[model samples]
Target: MIVLRNLTLRRGARRVLDEASAVINPGEKIGLVGRNGAGKSSLFALLAGTLHEDAGECLVPSVWRLAQVAQEMPETAQSATDFVIAGDAFLMAAQAEAHAAEASGNGERMAHAYTALTDAGAHDAHARAQALILGLGFRMDELNRPVNSFSGGWRMRLQLARALMCPSDLLLLDEPTNHLDLDALVWLESWLKRYEGTLLVISHDREFLDAVTRVTLHIERGKLTRYGGNYSDFEALRAQQMLLQQAAYEKQQAQIARLTKFIDRFKAKASKARQAQSRVKALERMERLAPVLAEAEFSFAFNTPTGLPNPMLVLRDVDCGYLPPVGASADTPPSLIVRQVSCTIAAGQRIGILGANGQGKSTLVKTLVGALPLLSGGRVEGKELSIGYFAQQELDVLRPRDSPIEHLTRLAHTVLPEGESRREQALRNYLGTFSFTGDMAYQPVGTMSGGEKARLVLALIAWQRPNLLLLDEPTNHLDLATREALSVALNEFEGAMILVSHDRALLRAVCDEFWLVAHGRVTPFDGDLDDYQQFLLDDARRQREAEKRARMQNGQAEQTSAVRKREYAAARQTAAQLRSLKRAQEKLDSQLHTLQMHKQAIEARFAEESLPVDEITVLGNELKALNEALDAQEERWLTLAEEIERIEAASS
Candidate 1:
């Protein structure tokens, strides 16, 4: 158990926690939430034994092992698996002891050390580490790659995996989902649910907190409050409390006003002097209630587009991926990731991109945003098309040396019309709408927090008044309130949108359709996010099984006989057949969907009273034809799907 008794903590001159106290029992999963800079991180430091309370008691069981993700980026040549396995301190210590005993030529000591190493599960360490790595969105081949070869974001993921690998009674995670995609985030949620330890996480993602935490611990105005249940429950209960508190305060103010009026009128009169004095005494004895101040509200909306271009952009058989390296030959063709993706973006259409990490979701988005060149196929834009893109690494586009006002002023020059005012004050006023005000507007962007940086990028995008928006991981650094505001703004946006995000709430609120990028193809996802999550889990399970089988095969003696070669050839043929059938099934499914939609549209026209008898007859006949086509496509789709299933079953 951990206990805090009237704990007071400070960072520099500011008191982050003032006489705040809370008790956390062992094995309880707690969510530590607060507005940005509300001392959540400070509290985590206190628990991690890095920061001491200024006064009062902060206690944790001395025997308990603790684990936390390291903040510093790792720069090592060690293989990813080895780096993760090193997280297990106990196993490492035991192995070191065994080595030392063998070097000393002490048989008894070596035997004891070997026993301890086995007890620590040294034999399965590699497997466990690899599982954590793969579950965090790394490919199987990346397991042997040097840690430093990965990007900063992937390195952070490795750090998280390392923390999870450590054996601990307590685990502290801070913004764990910041670098994860939806697939990895879902996998992490499942993993955390099964962890048998006390867990405390600091996150601004409401859905994540709701999913992982059973208890909510909120830090506000230097006070710590613990609530029973998840973040949603805490929000409901807190809102109710605020309402009651406000009501009580209003009633008290009314009573105080009445008392003052009575005292002022009668205090001077001789006959009423005693009564006036008594009223004054009553006022002095009353306990004053403090006004309930709401948290600072932050909201912004996208400026309505000057023109709504129907079918803002079209990608025709586009092969989307990365271009060759800078030093490579100019004639070299781009490496294709998603092949032959054909999609149209119309006014008011909202599309969500879903896929496992490294499966071309980002590649497709980059191509659409015109940041990456198409490997093949042509891209068409409407006459009045205007695009605003928010890349996953949006911060890289910002000039850190420039202030918000300077950034906006430069944007105004390029985006705003000539007649529009580009004065510093006007730009400052505009920046204020996104909560950058006064000196903060003039503050250097490099010194701003991640949330502030993200807000600035959004503000820049809004100023464009684009009819089409492409956003990738836009909510990564935003707080819950800001995310809610963004969701509301997006819902009201009349522009077409393509979004790639790990935030399920945002996806559900903004997307009208979903496109899945997988296996070098872009296809429509027929179901919702829940279905996508289940698909990822199933895929992960299958991949693990395949890896196990491959390992088993590798351990066996090589079979070079003609019979074995023939068997392998037959297996490859079956696999190719399965792939072809799946592609055919996808095509038929798309055809069926189109026919069904056409049928529904025609049927809906029959309800119109303005339609004449002849028109109704024509619509009825067209609907019948659509239904027939739909039935035929559906039958073919089912047959192909069944064949795919059969092939899959045989392979398994």
Candidate 2:
């Protein structure tokens, strides 16, 4: 359990939490939400014990094991699997001790060390870590790759997987879905649902929070408020509360008005003097209800395009990818990530691109937008066609040192016809429509938050008056409010759009059709997001089965038919033994669970300090016996697992 009592926290001179109090019970899944600088991360730091409160107490159970994703990018030569496995401190420590014991030739120490390893589930740790890696969208082949070989986004996924790998009592995840695709996000949602621990997550993804969290904790105006149910529930409840508050304030104001009028009209009359004095006292004693202040709202729309071009673009037998940089060998061919792509995008078609990560969704979008040259096939564009493209990496489109006004001005210079260029004041007015006004228009792009940068990109796109928009993960850094605004704008857009995003809410709101990019092929997918999620699951299952088959077929190229028959028979016999051993292992697991529960109960009683000395001694001895028995069972379980692995390897 965690408790924050009258907490006052600060970051430098700014107060983040003022006289705030909240309670988070064990096993509760909480979603923390607020505006961009509302101090969600600072609260997480307080819980993690890295930040101290300026006043009041933040208490967390001393015995609870907490886990959180690392903020820094991991730089290491360790294999991905090894890095994930290292998350389980107990397993790693046990393995190290066992190795040391074996090296020292200490019989008793080796026995204890091996027992500890088994208790830590070291035998299955690799498989568990690999499952986490796969769920986070890492291909099986990439598991053995060095951690340093991955890009920053992929490395963040690794960090999330490692955090999930830990055996913790409390898990804190902040924006875990930032770099994940729809497929990986779905997998993560399922995995988190099955996590047997308290979870506190900070996310702007409403669908994700709705799926994973049962409670909502909102931070506003330096106060923490708890609400029952998910984000949707919180929104509904908050609306009702605001309505009631407004009503109460209105009623109170009416009463005060009547009393003031009565006192003013009858205060000098002899017959009504007593009543006027009473009314004055009543007004003086009455507490005034403050009117509820509504939250600030922002709305922006995309500018109407100058023209709508039917059959906006057509791709026939297209090979989409990037070419080698200049000065490279002429023999080097264009590297195609997607091939044989053929489609026609018509005016006002809102198409959502769906695929797993690294499956060429972005590449296809870039090719269609003319950012990359087509290696082969024809691309036909309609007359007066103009495009506004948003890249997934904001840096690819935004100038670091330039301000928003400068970017828009430069764009106007290139896009505007002669004698039609807008003045500086006019450009700033246009920027203001996207929420950039005054000094914000002159702020350096590099100094802006991700949400600010994304908004700036949208502002730039809107300024061009393009007939088509190609947005690749445009909502990657946007908050929920900004995402909502974008969705509304896209719905009202008069031109065509192709969006490659993992945001299910935005996709559902803006797109009417879906196109899938997979296995170097582009095709129409006749389904919704739910169906696509199932497709990804089915694909992952097939991938795992294929890997199993490949492992079985390893090193058997020259085997004769008779040898194969013998090996098959041996495999069947080994499988039978493994099944029997697995049943025994299950029974042992059940017994271990029971014994551990009983031991915990005993320890709890012992901690009460009310038990007699003799009784305490008896409880301690019983716990010792239970531990010994559990250790023996664990050792046996490990042996069975090793034997099964050996048989499977030999059969292969």
Candidate 3:
């Protein structure tokens, strides 16, 4: 457990926290909520011992451990497993020391060292480490890869995996879900649900916090207030709190007015003199409460001009795709071909392309935009044909040396052609409109995050306000809050959009039509993207049910082939072998428990005997080894339990 005893934090001239006291109890999962610069990260760092509170003590038990996501990369190369193992560094060091003592002719020290390492789970700690590593989405083959080879995002994941590996009474996690994908987020949510230790996490991911945390500690205007319930419930309760505060303020003001009138009328009277002074003191002492504004939200609305051509883009007997460069053609694709393929996209057409990986949805868009040449016959037409393309192509068009503002300032004039002076001023103001406030406007384009860079590029393009929007996975690397803002903006947009995205929710919200590209052909469908999700789900369900029925009826109609019979027998034998192995593991675990406890007993006796400091140190080594062994056995049991549960569930 960890306790923040009257903590005070300041940022420059601002008081971010003032005498805030909070307790994080064991097994309690908490969500830290606050606006930007409300000291959430600072508080987390303080808890992690990476930052000083300046005023109050953070009281944490010696056994309490904290884990934080590394926003920056470490110097050395490391793999996913290496990252998690780093969390076990303390125990690993103890292990090495225990072995060294045994070699140095100190039998008591050797015995004590062995016990401490064993108790700390050194015997089979690798399996525990691997399990924790795998839970965070590491492939078995990636265990040995250098951590430096990973991009910043993957490095964050490695940092997170290591944090999860650390067994601590209390854990503080900051923005834990920022780099996580939906699937990994779900897994981590489930893991936290079953975690026994106390945890406090600062995350912008609503669904994640809702699923995992029980307590919401909302930081508003540098004040800490705890709310009971999940995030949605917290929001509702916060709204009620705001309303009540306003009501109280109004009641106080009304009474103050009455007092003012009474004092003014009775000012000349002797009794009124004391009463007026008292009222003035009350007014002076009253802390006037300011209203808390709602979170910042983006407003999205755009309209297409009338008198547009129908069937704007069309392809006939054309293959739309590109192959990697061949021979000396550095940037040229081999070709993209569609045989007897015909397609037409008209004004007001909202389409989504659905296909497996490696399908040419992006290629089709490139061909339409003239970024890729059409291989066959096609006619494309649009009235005044203005288009805005937001691709996943890295937005590498921005010159790295130039500031974001400088690049954007140049693009506006170049793209608009006749904008000249007035438009440049409006464009500068527009960049500020999208959070490029003052100094941020001058930050180098290369220095921005992927999400920020994408938004900046989109801002420049949107300034022109084109008729067509071609977006490809625009939500990648964006935090959920930003994604929500983008959603609102897209909803207000009126231009025809051709979107290719893996986000079902986004596609459902924005699209009115669906397009499927496969085998170099185009298939158009009526209705919205929700229909596509339904179709996919329904198909998957039907396939699953069909497989279940087939499996059940296998013996009735078709006897198993000899090859299948052999496979079944092999599976049964493997299951039996695993069961036998599980029993042996349980037996070994029981014996190991006895050994570790005996070692602890010896160390405790040594501590009570008032021996020399060196003798006590020898006993301490034994205790450390004992702890490691216990951890290792516990880890083994967990793995066996999981394996057995899975096998039983699958059979059932």
Provide the TM-score for each candidate, comma-separated.
0.83, 0.82, 0.66
Alpha-carbon lDDT, every model: 0.89, 0.88, 0.70
lDDT of 1 by residue, 1-652 (tens): 9999999999999999999988898878899988888899899999999999999899999999999999999999999999999999999999999999999999999999999999989998998899899889999789999999999999999999999999999999999999898888987986886677899999877888888887889898999988766789789978998999999999999999999999999999999999999999999999999999988978999999999877789999999888888899879977888999998888899999998777898899889988898889999998888899998788978999999999998888886676546888778888999999999998999999899999999999998888899999999889888999999999999899999998898999999899998899999899999999889877877887787779869886665689778977998899788778777865774576467556646766887679998998888788888878866886776677667666755775
lDDT of 3 by residue, 1-652 (tens): 6777788888777888888887776667889987656788788877777778768777878776655566667656766666677777667678788979978989999988888888887766677677665555555567778878766766777788777776666777887765554335655876786566788988766767887886788876676887666677688878897789888878887877887787788778896788887877777887776544656744333445434556567777776655565564676755664445677777777777775334577787777777876666675767777777887765677676787678776776566567454354665677777777778888887877776787776776677677777887676656445667777777777667788766555667777777876566778866554465455445445655676668768865654688669867976876796678678765864566476447646755885855789877877887788778866876776676677666744642
10 residues in a row with least lDDT, candidate 3: 298-307
Highest lDDT scorer: 1
| TM-score for predicted model 3 compared with the true structure | 0.66
Off by over 4 Å in 2: 96-112, 266-274, 417-421, 555-652
Decreasing lDDT order of the candidates = 1, 2, 3
Off by over 4 Å in 3: 11-14, 74-87, 98-152, 261-287, 293-408, 417-425, 428-432, 435-458, 470-483, 497-652
Task: Please list the Cα RMSD from the true structure of every candidate, rounded to 1 decimal place.
Answer: 16.2, 9.7, 13.0
